[model samples]
Target chain A: MTRCRFWRLDRHPEGNTDFARFLSLQEEDCAPLADGEVRIATEWLSMDAGTRMWMSPRTDGYQPPLPLGSKMVGLVLGRVIESADAGYPVGALVRGFGQWADVATVVPALTGLEVVDETVADPRQHFGALGMNAWTAYVGVKEVASVKPGEWLVVSAAAGATGSLACQVGRNLGAKVVGIAGGADKCRYLTEEVGVDMAIDYRNEDVDARLAEVPGGVNAFFDNVGGPILDAVLGNMAHYGRVAVCGMVAGYDTDAPMPGPAKFDQVLMRRLRIEGFFIPDFLHRGAEFMPQLREWLDAGKLAVRFDETAGLENVLTAYERMLTGKNIGKVVVKL
Target chain B: MTRCRFWRLDRHPEGNTDFARFLSLQEEDCAPLADGEVRIATEWLSMDAGTRMWMSPRTDGYQPPLPLGSKMVGLVLGRVIESADAGYPVGALVRGFGQWADVATVVPALTGLEVVDETVADPRQHFGALGMNAWTAYVGVKEVASVKPGEWLVVSAAAGATGSLACQVGRNLGAKVVGIAGGADKCRYLTEEVGVDMAIDYRNEDVDARLAEVPGGVNAFFDNVGGPILDAVLGNMAHYGRVAVCGMVAGYDTDAPMPGPAKFDQVLMRRLRIEGFFIPDFLHRGAEFMPQLREWLDAGKLAVRFDETAGLENVLTAYERMLTGKNIGKVVVKL
Candidate 1:
């Protein structure tokens, strides 16, 4: 029997910091695979802000809260070590919602487990440009927000995984992209590295004043951090603007409900369309999006800067980094 | 020179109750029509809540603020007394955005002036089943909200003009209709006269609790009153539901911007769409919508219960009654 290390949720989180107090790392003998289950030797773990809501006890989240004492679940990338499912052959490169363990087990269908293309140079791109984050960006910018060529597309949390990809997606589609990030460093990365048209350092600059300079107002907004940032964008949108609510990272830290954008009435005032979307709900359409993403990757039109943390022991650190807006790009734990 | 009795906006109104303090009923000598202008012998005025925003100094509204001292603008139904434009000939029954006056002058093209069908037994139907309100309900329920057959549709301000028409439109589309109103009498009217499947009296009843009883949650919402009522519906919407934001009467009474719905985060949780639409924006499509509305009216399938107020002097009383939710249906001032 193989020994596996995993994090277990002991209690709901209170704040962004001190996540370890509620989760404990434990070692146990790996259980025999049940029918239709596959085991992965976890090589990498993607740290996502949306998972914070799963740790919360709030029933109003996208999905039900993870019960206490359960192994912490997340998107994992690795080779399939063992399989009870014929589709997931052993040694196949796979990615899905699996445990934060060295040996992660998952129900093939439930965890959205799929074998990824191995031809790509860096397999980590499966969790980057070719990942769910990229899919979210593609769907939000192109389909939901309906960004037209030559339109002004504004992205909140633009230094993060999804927003960065959203900016690129908007640019590829011929939209003028404006990115809003928390720090000067992140803003610099967005403008210099990601090559966005404009980057607003939200923490250091007047976001409202900066956005006001965009002629004809923002045509589409891909919002990852909702709260006051959402309010700022709402007030600056053009008539008939579309807002794609991708994630509300601003409210994920607490159990208390997030106060909505104060300027929400602007929806009517400006004839705006605000639509909220969660990526997991759209997972089945991955095959439909991958070819274009794979092309973007091959052409160097799409790229992601990885903020990698070594070892499973630092999973909480990476999570906190992503949650606290300290990471400039996709934060992931390498086991 | 012909004389006219018009309501002038002396000052921006501070509240819904004291309209008399800001607006005065004044007598004016009718000015000569400009080259493209048309004048109407105003017979009746449509008291729409959306007009309240024009009386406010808020520059951020759908249109620029109406200048103080301007004649209060509203939908006028009457015969064209004179016209420099060929489309609106003398003695032609018409409806357009004109003044709240006995003799309303308008620039034909700007006000969306159209010669109405005078053959209908009740000419008031131009301000009723065949009116802009009907067009609003048709477009909002069918196009914006996209209420489908067998889906559950909820309409707020169910006893008012657009709301009542929305309820009927939803019903006509084979939807299970739910109406939310302020009073028991209105609730009764919604269920009995409008024939809605469910009626929620928001003023006295537990709205959230009642909505929880809806099987599979509300699929579409036509919100005329936005405030706490919007929050209640947002919390109870089904996954992938649509909300057509038609009006914000709750905020229209005051100059202050309305606080957003507290449960707006539910938009993400449920993957919902909230879109705002102004009726005037869709005015050009009236000809495309009128045939179906006229058919519905002639078939007796669509009817508007009129809350008629007599005389121009009682316009303030009628306006206050409609604004305060004292009227059961379409409130019109018979000039």
Candidate 2:
């Protein structure tokens, strides 16, 4: 029997550390797959706040619960060693929904799993800067927010994978970008490295008052952190502002009820637009983003930062660390 | 000097009241229009809930306080018996911003004052069904919400002027329209008269559970009343649903906080779009809406309900009654 480690919901996550406990899977002993199935060896894993809500029972019956003993759900970069499906071949490096384990089998319906090109400078970039995180940031800022040149684009969790990419995308579109991060170091990296016009360490200064510095106030806000920050930003937004609700990183771990009676009152009185978007919602536009992002990268207008963790053994720890805002950019686990 | 009576917010309305307070404006003794002004005798007056928010401090700081001992701000129909402006002719029956008073002098800039064609059915219909309330309802549902054919559209304050017009507009667009109202009488009018697909008396029925009857779930929700009912309707929304934030009649008198939390979690997960709009935001789109609405009106596909009150003396009472959902359809005071 082949032994593989897996992360499962620990019946209950007591606190931050509960992100630590995951079960081991004996893959060779599990039930056999039906006709169209493929087995993979997971190389890299992506961690996000959305995964936490999926594990929780409080999701209003919208999300299915993570079965007590089943492997946790996540996106991963892996190689297909075996296949019952003709489309995906052995030795292909593909990315898709996979168990947190090193090896897993998936059906054809779970096929967002696409083979990666070996010619790229770094294969991991396909799962990070040029991947789902960056693509989501790009589409939401450009399409949903409809941000125009010279407008102020404010983003929270601004040094993280999606947030940093969003700030860069905003700048490339000629918008004045303001980033909100947790500490001084992250804020510096966002403004100096990512080329954001301004940076706010939300842990220190007041977000709403500092927004007055933008003069005309924010035109579009790409939010990765939601809670008091969302409430504060909504109050200072300009009339007819657009807010792209991207992630709720701030509210995930709190024992307290979600920190909002979010001032949606401002939403009406100011005639603002707040839209929520998931990356997969715009997957059809994936090809469109690739060429444009490639152009920016080729011109050195795009800069990517990776918080690289070596080996799959530290994957769970890296995920926990990512959630606590320890990583500066894309959190990537290297094989 | 002729005495003109009006209602003052003597105090910010703590709760819905009869709105008892004396406000008077004296008739001008010398009223030849000075260069670019017009002197007019006011005939009809309109009192709306929009005046409520402007009472405290301007929420957007765009409008100023209605000064003590001054006339209340509203729209009125009047005859320009005297005109100093070359553009505005004498004896012109114009509709524009005026006081709750019987007469006033106004400049061209403060006036959208249009010359009325008296041959039309119910000149007040121009101010009611075809006026700001109806126009707002039209633009919000058509432009902002973008209600398409066969989509489920639900509206709050379903028997009010805007609500009634929105139901017709939704129907004209081939949408299945649902309305939520306070009483059975309003619900009956919404279905039997305004011709909605379904009507929910929020006071009597379980709003969330009954919405399951709509099958596909509401695709668009035109919210006039902002309170618990909005919270209830939110649960029954489909993915990618649109919410047009028009008014907050339910919380017009609310001084303290209500129980509804910010629904960002559901919003993000469902990929919903929530937008607040002022009618003027789409003034540029009137060239698009007017011809189509006129076509619908001429084809008899659209209908309107008007609650016409007579005399300026009843304006304050009518306005207060509107806040409490007392009137059905467009609440207007005819000359």
TM-score of each: 0.99, 0.93
lDDT of 1 by residue, B1-335 (tens): 98999999999998788799999999989988889889899998999999999999999998999999899999999998888999889999999999999999999879888888879888778888998999999999999999999999999999999999999999999999999999889999998899999999998999999999999999999999889989999999999999999999989877778888899899888999999999999888999999899888878878799999999999999999999999988999897
lDDT (Cα, tens digit) per residue for candidate 2, span A46-127:
7655676656656452356677767777778888888888888999988776777777678746546777666778777776
Give candidate 2 misplaced runs (Cα > 4 Å): A1-3, A12-15, A21-33, A59-62, A254-261, B1-12, B22-32, B58-62, B254-262, B282-288
lDDT of 2 by residue, B25-92 (tens): 24444434477777677877766676666554444532565655555677777888778776779888
A153-272: candidate 1 lDDT, tens digit per residue: 999999999989999999999999999998889988999888899999889999999999999999999999899999999999999999999999888887877987899889999999
Candidate 2 TM-score to native: 0.93
Note the Cα lDDT for every prediction shown: 0.93, 0.75
Q: Which candidate comes out best when scored by DockQ?
A: 1
Best candidate (score: TM-score): 1
Give the clashing pairs for model 2.
B161-B329
Among all windows of 10 consecutive residues in model 2 chain B, the one with the lowest summed lDDT is B22-31
